[model samples]
Target: MVTQDELNEKGKAAVMDFDGDVVAEIAEECISAGLDPIDLIQNGFTAGINEVGTQFEQGSLFLPHIIAASEAMSAGVEVLTPVLENLSAQAEDKGTVAIGTIEGDIHTIGKDIVATMLKVAGFNVIDLGRDVPIADFVEVVKEKKPAIVGSSALMTTTMVLQLQVEEQLKEAGVRDTVKTMVGGAPVTQDWANRIGADIYAENASDAVVKCKAAFE
Candidate 1:
């Protein structure tokens, strides 16, 4: 059985090495040793990613390193996700957030970051991935009853889909059921308000703050 200190060390090195497989193995070991998935993620994996983000921003790390760290964190998440989901505390949720990059928008870096941040902050995120159509958003909202729905668009052309999603949600009579939030390279708070989205997050971290506010 791996000790807690060893697992923590492995988790930290996994991020530094950008080794997703190593991260996953460490997480699995921790679980096999009876460690809590939520605890590992919140205290270990999240801290690693936040550090990577800072380093990347400060030019101490390059894009390749960032991608590797993201991949490693994602791998750890894959192993921990089921365990987290089965835990009673996780089931209760800080809040349910449905997220996606609008239709015609294949850009996902921003959405991925926001989703990760939300997860780190204890929000249950249902990510729709990229290029999601209007129907998916409406169907998910109806099925999951999420407290917040978020959309991202990197291009002006794809930004229109954010409005389309809002319109569909309204038409489905579930607009009021969720607080809509939108963001990306070309989005603005005014645009969010104009399109009937309840909030606009300026960045990934800001998304967490805004969603927290919406839930509060």
Candidate 2:
């Protein structure tokens, strides 16, 4: 019998090793063993990716490694998506969040991870997807009235679009209503402050922490 701790370690190793097949296998094994999928995601795979993020920050890992690990994590998440959805349906609603990658930047891996983490954390996440225009964010804020809006930009050029999101949100008369969060490789706390964003998340776990703190 595989104890939860061992399975958790296997899940983490699968992601750290960038083995999508192993991650998927772990996901299936968890389901078969009736282990909590969310537990595996949060404590196992999410923990793995969080370490990867730390390594990247410390210059021990690079973009390619991050991308591969993210993909591997995504594979495990895909297998758990159905179960997650079922569990989420029965769970109490947390605050809503609208998240996306800003215009001119089509990067989705980081954005996807954050969105998934938020959902797993019990937030009703409206994923606006990659290459989202500034106006779309404003429209969603106006229409959905989510508690938080998150924008991602992988390039220095596109990071300026996060500023535009702040400006446009104010223009739409919802700047005060919703908190704004900015992230991506090129985004820094300084840039987030310059753009008047309420939160600057360095990675997915940080995003979940700051976003949850917004409502507290």
Top TM-score prediction, candidate number: 2
lDDT of 2 by residue, 12-70 (tens): 99999999999999999999999988678777887787778789889999989888988
lDDT digits (tens) for residues 52-157 of candidate 1: 7677768999767767776887888778766654553453468789999988877665687678668767888899999998899999999999998899997789
lDDT of 1 at 136: 96
Q: Give every collision pair in model 1.
A: none
Note the residue pairs that clash in candidate 2. Answer: none
Give me the runs in candidate 1 sitting further than 4 Å from their true place.
Answer: 1-92
Q: Which candidate is the best by lDDT?
A: 2
Task: For model 1, state the Cα shift of residue 96 in Å.
Answer: 0.3
Question: lDDT of each prediction vs. the true structure?
Answer: 0.80, 0.88
Error of 1 at 195 (Å): 0.8
Candidate 1: residue 210 lDDT (0-100): 85
| Prediction 1 global C-alpha lDDT | 0.80
Provide the clashing-pair count of each candidate structure: 0, 0
